[model samples]
Target: MSMTEAQTTTRKQALGSPLDRADGRLKIQGLATYAIEKSLENMAYAVVVQSTIPHGRIRSMNIERARQSPGILAVYNHHSGLIIHPAKTFGQGGAAAQAFLPLQDDKVLWNGQHIALVVAETLEQATEAAALIETEYEQQAAIVHPDNPDARPETVDALTIEWGDAVPALAQAEVQIGGVYTTPREYNSPIEPHGCIAHWQDGSLTLWEPSQWVGGARQVVSEWMAIDREKVRVISPYVGGGFGCKGGIQPHSALACVAARELKRPVKLALTRPQTFTAFGGRPRTHQQLALGASRDGTLQSIVHDSWNETALNDVHKEPCNAVTPLMYASPNFLSHHKLIHLNTVNPSWMRAPGENPSAFALEVAMDELAWALKMDPLALRLKNYAEQDPQAKIPWSSRQLREAYQQGADAFGWSKRPLEPRSLREGRQLIGWGMASGTYPVRRTPGEAQIVLYADGRLEVQSSGVDIGTGTYTILAQTAADVLLVAPESITVLLGDTLLPRAPVAGGSQLANLLTGAVHKTALALRDMLITLAVSTEKSPLWQQSPAALALADGFLWLSDKPNLRVSFSELLRLSGNDKLIAHQDTFATTASEDDRNKADSTSSMMVPPTEGGVSAHSWSAIFVEVAVDEDFGTVRVKRMVGAFDSGRIYNPKLTESQWIGGMVMGIGQALLEEGAIDDRDGRITNANLADYLVAVNADIPELTTIDVGKPDYLATVLGGKAVGELGIVGVAAAISNAVWHATGKRIRDLPITQDKLL
Candidate 1:
C-alpha cells in the first residue's frame, strides 16, 4: 500500500504497558557480553608492534631477541604465512580504510602502521614483549598538508554537480564573498576501544568484535584471510559505541585471527586507548575554498566550492566536503569539486555525517558572513533562499519542515531579544551571543530482513542481524514487534548481532530504524495473518470459516470485525494449531531508481530510499540554537545553554529519544570546541595520541541543555512512520556553535574547535 493509505489508517494507541527494552536489565547489570568480555578456553593475548616513524621503510626487523623473551608464543609479520596477502587497492573515494592490513608488507607508509604482532600467554607479557622487539628504518620526508608546495595531486574521488555557468554568473553578480575554511583531523573516541577475540577452528574463524556493521566486518575478514565468506562468523551482541569508527573491519581483527590460527588457541587483541588513534580510524582533515556570489537582495547567484583532502599512500579516501552547499540553498549556478592529495597519514574514514558536518561548517559560516555583509538577519536570508525542492536532485522532499523548524526554534529561543551587532552584549567581562543553524540529513533506507517467532507460552521472539550500537535499536525493535503482535515487550525476546540470523543492513547512516523496523512490522503482519488463517480453518473455532481480512488481532486476542465479544486468545490459538512455535521471515527491498537520477550512478546514493512519507523513506529535521559566553581575553568559548527542536517522526520512547538528542548535543559540543587530533608535522606522528592530551567534551564543559521532540508522524517512510533522527541531532550543531562564537567575539573563526590560540 502507498504511504498515504497507511497513514489514513487510524493511529492505534500503543498496547500493553510502555515497552521496556528486553536487554536493559542485562546491560545495566553488566551481564551483557561485549566483545572484550568474551572468554574462551586457552585464550592468549596479542600486542601489536607499530611504526614509530610516520614515513619510512623498515630496513630490517630483529625479532630473534624478543621471540626468546619469556611468555612469548609466536611473533608474526608480513612473511609469516604464504596465504596472507596484502590488502588489495580498492577503487577510490570514501571506500578506503584507515589502517591497512597488518604484516602485509614491510614498508611503513604512515606512522603507527602495524609492523609486527606478538602473541603471549598473558596480556602483560604480550605487551612487554611487543616493546622489546626492535626495528631499523630509513626515514623519508612527508607531505601532510595540501598547502605544501611539494604536495602531489591525486584523484581519490570526484563528484560534479553542475547547473549553470558559475564563473560567468559570479562575474555578473553584484556581491561576492570568498574564503578558505579548514577542519582539523579528529578521532571518534568511543568509551570502548576497538577490540576483538578470534578463534580459528578447523580453518573456520569465529570472532567476537565490537562493531556497528557485522556483515561488513565479516566481508573484510573473509577477504583478508582469503577464506570463504561463510567461514567467518562475527558476533557483536553489545557495542559500547562506534560513532562510525567501528563500521569497517580494522587490522586488529585480522591480526587476532592470524594469531589464533598460528597458536591454535583463541587470541584477544584490544588496542590501548592511545593506540586506537592510529590503529582504528579518524576523520580526515578538510581544506576547502568557498566562493559565493549573490544579489544585493541576498539571493544566491552562484556558489563554487573546491576542496582538497589527504588520504594514505596505500588507499584513497575523499570526503564530499562541499556536498551540502549546492542543495542547501536555491542557487542558479553552482559547482562542487573535490581532489585527494596523498599524505603519510593513516587513511581517514567516515565519522558522524562525514561529508555534511564539515561541509555545513564552511557553508553555514559563509552564509552567516554573507548575512552580515548584506546587513540582513541570518535566519531571514536563509528563509529567502530555502529550496522548496532539493536543488541537487531536482525532487520534492518527502517532507521538509525546515521553515517550521526555524520559526519554532526562533520563537522558543527568544530570538527577538538578541542584539543585531556582534560583541554588543557583555556581562562581567564575558561576551554573550546566541546563534542558530538549520540541519538536514538525506533520508536513507536499504533492503532489510527480519524473522519473528510466536511461542505457545504467550511470548514473541524477534531476530535480526542489526547491531544496536547504543541507539536503542533493541528497545525500538521490541516495541515495534510488541505493538504489532499485541504482546508485552518483556515477554518478547529480541535477538541480534549474529550474521547467521536474517540478513539486516548495517547500523550506519542513521537508517537502521527506517530500514529494519519496516521488515519487523511486515513480519509481524504476516504472523498475524497466519494465526488468523489457522483459527479460520479450525472446525472448532468461534468463526470457523471467517475471512482473514474481516478479523483483527488486538490485546493478544483475535475477534471478528462485527463481533468483539467472540475472541480467542493467542495462546489458545497456538495450542489449537498443535505447534509450540510459529516463525515467519520478511525481506523489504528498495524501490527501483529512475533512469534520470544521477545519484543512482554513484554508489553512495544508489541504495538511498526514495522520497516517501512513511514506507522507509523519511528524513529527520532539527534546529539547534546555542548560547555562547566567550572570554575575549583568554579566547575561551563556553556553551552556556543549548535548545534543540527535532521532528524525528514518532518517538518510540520519549525518554530514550530525549536521551539520544542530549547525547548528540553533547557530542556536537565536543566537535565544536574540544575535539581535535594533533599531528607532529616534523615526523607526521600523532603527538597527542591519548585521551589525556586529545581533548573531548567533559562534564564541566557541558551546560544546561533542553531537547524538544516535535513528534510529528511521518506517514511516508516506514511502518513506524519514524525518520532517522540519530545523526540529524548532530549534523548542523557545529555550525550553530561556531556561529554563536562569531556573534560573541566579533571574529569569524574559520577553523574548527574554535581554540583559544585561534581566538587570540
Candidate 2:
C-alpha cells in the first residue's frame, strides 16, 4: 500500500505517534527519485582522475590517448580554463566544504585531489577514459598526521573557553583524574554515495544532486558561476543518507557544473566508493587530553581540556573537541581550548555530532575514571556534577531533564543490581559489566519560510526548500500541518528539497525539523485564520458573525466551540467565498547574517532579519546505559543491550525519534568497537577507502536497544518546543561502551574503536 493509503487504512493519529514515514512506500518501491537519477536529453557522463602524490605540482599530462578513445567528448585539466569561481568555505558561510577549488591549478594539496575530469558519451566510456589519463607530478614531503613532528598546531581563539585558574585548582584538588583519548579519522559512507547531474538550458542552470542543503547548494553554484541566483536551481527530493558528507557542496559538484556549462550538454558525475573518501570531507582524527579535579565527596572543582584534530593544509576546519567540556559540568575553575593540526589530507567536515561525539567520549571517560577514584558510582558522580544552568554561557537552561533521564535510564537498565567492581559479574566464559554516560547537544534554529495551501478539495500542501536527510522531516511536516488543521495526515502533501519552494536553512546541525515545523505551524495557524475569516464573512455560512476566537476547527469542519450545530465545512466555506484554495506563508526564527552569523546564513530574497534572542540557553540532554559481555580468551566484546533516556524537548514523532536514537546507538557501537579510517602515512592516502577495509556496525553488531523520552515543552527555545535530536543519540554512546569495557576487564582503553588487539 502507498504511505498515504496505509495511514488512511490504519486510522493513525498525527504528531507524537508511531506514524510510519510518509515516504516509506516510495523508497521501498524504488519510485523515489534521488540526485543523478534525473535523466536529461543528450546527457554526457564524466569521471574524475585523482592525484597520486600527497602534495605536489602537476609537471606534465598526456591526454592524447584518452582523447583518441571512442566516445570521449572532452577531457578537462587545470589548463582547460574551466570558468568556475572560488566559493567561501562552509565555515565562512558558503556552501563549499573546503576553500580550495580542485582542478583549478597545477598545485596538488592532498592525495586523491581531483586533477582532471573526462567526459564521454557513456558511463563505460567515461570510466575507461578517466583511467587512461596519466600525469607526472613533482612530489614534496608531506606532513600527513597530527603527530608528525613537522606539523604545527594552531589554537582557534573562538573555540577557547576559560574562566578561572584551572591549573592551580587541579594542583590543589584533593583528588584528580586525567587521561588522553584519541579517535581515528572516520568516513561518512552513505549507502548511495555522492553524485550530481548538471543541466543548463535557456540561460539557467539546473543541478540534481543529493545535497543536504539544497538552498545553500544553489547559492554556492550561483556565486561560483558568477550568475544571478535565480538562474540556478537545485533539486534533491531524496538522499540515501548524508551524515555531513553531502552537507556542503563538494568539488565534484562544481566540476560537473563547469563541464556542463563549457560543453553545453548535461553532464553526470558519480564518485566511486574510494573517491568518496577523498572527494568530500569526513570526521577528522582527534587527540584529546582531559583532566578533572574533584573533592573527596565527588564535587567537581576544575575541568581542563585541550584537543587537536587534523585539518587539510589547503583549508582550516578544526574539530573543536573541547566544545562540550564547559557545558558538561559545573566547576569552580574551567579551561578548554581547541587547536587544528595541518595535515596533507582532505579538509575534515562535521560527521554526525562532530565536536560533541569525540569530546563527549573524552569527558565522559574521564568522569568514569574520577568515579573510580572517588569510590562512587559513575552515575552518582555525573549526577553530582550536573549543571542546573549552562556553566559556560552563564544562562539558565530553557529546559533540562537530564536528572530525570539519568534516573529513568538507570531504573530501566537495572543499574542498582550491578556489581561495583570490575569482573564481578560473569556468565560462563563471558565477563559482564554495566556502564553509563551523559550526552548533550546544542539546540540551534535558523529562520526559514514555509508555504501552506488548503485546497477546496480537502487536501493540504506544505512546501519548503528543506531536505529530509532521512530524519523524518517529511513526516514531521505532514504531521504538523495535519494536527494544526485538524485533518487526516493522509490528506496532506509535503514538498521539499527544491529551490522553487520557500527558503529554508540547510538540513544540518539537527535544526531542520525544529525550523521547518515552526514555520509550518505559523503558516497553518494563519491558514486557519483565513479559513475562519472566509466562513465568518459569507452570509450563507452558519459561522457568520462569530468571532474567530469562538470558532474551532475539527474533522475538516469549522464550528462554534460553544454550539457544535453551527458549522461549515472547509470546502463549503471556500466555495461560498469563491476561492479554490486558501494559501498562507510565514517566516519563523529568522536571523540576520552578520560576519559572526555567516554559519547560519539564509540566501533567499527575504531580507535577513534578527532572531528573537532568548536569555536561556537551549540544549538536548541524554543518559545512556550499556551492558556488555567480554570473551575471556578471544578478547571479543559484545554489546548486549543499551538504554538511552533523552530530554530532546517535545519529540514530534516518537517512532521516528526512537529510530534515530537506535541508529545513533548502532553508530556508537561502531565508534567504540569497529569504525576507523586508516591513512597511509607515506602517501597520506586512506588505506581503507572502501567498505571492505573500513568497518561499521551492521545488524549482527547491534544489540537490544531502548529509548525513553523525558522531554517537555520549552517555549523559550522554539514555539514547537522540539530541540535537536539527530546528533544527540551518538553523543555519549562511545563513552558508555568504552566504560562498559573497562568495567568488564578493568582495562581502560583510552583510544577509540577498542579493538580486540587493544583489549588483548
- lDDT against the true structure, each candidate: 0.77, 0.87
* Per-candidate alpha-carbon RMSD to the true structure: 4.6, 3.4
Quickly count the clashes in candidate 2. Answer: 0
Name the best candidate (by TM-score).
2
lDDT of 1 by residue, 1-760 (tens): 3222322331232322234555778889989889889978998998988888977688888888778888999988766762454442223212114337677667788888888899889999889888888899998877766666777766433476678889899889888987998888988989899889999999999999987767666766776778886898989899898888877667777788878887789999989988888885678888889988999999999998888777777676667787678767899898878888878877787788777788888888888888888888888989989887777767666566777788777888887787779998897889998888877666667666799988888678899888899887887777677667665555568888887777665677788877777888899888988889988987777867998888876556787878877778778887876878889887675454342231222112234454443433245777788899998678789999988888877677676677778887888899899888888877777889988999989999999988776656666655566776777778778889988988998888888888899888
Deviation (Å) of 486 in candidate 1: 1.7
Tens digits of per-residue lDDT for model 2, 654-745? 99999898888888999899999988888988889999999999999987899999999877877888987988999999999999999999
Determine the C-alpha RMSD for candidate 2 after optimal superposition of all C-alphas: 3.4
TM-score of 2: 0.95
Candidate 2, residue 130: lDDT: 83
Residue runs of model 1 more than 4 Å from their true location after superposition: 1-22, 86-99, 155-157, 540-543, 546-550, 559-566, 590-619, 715-720
Q: After superposition, how far is residue 317 of candidate 1 from its true place, in Å?
A: 1.7
- Backbone clashes, each candidate: 11, 0
lDDT of 1 at 531: 87
Question: At residue 208, what lDDT does model 1 achieve?
Answer: 95
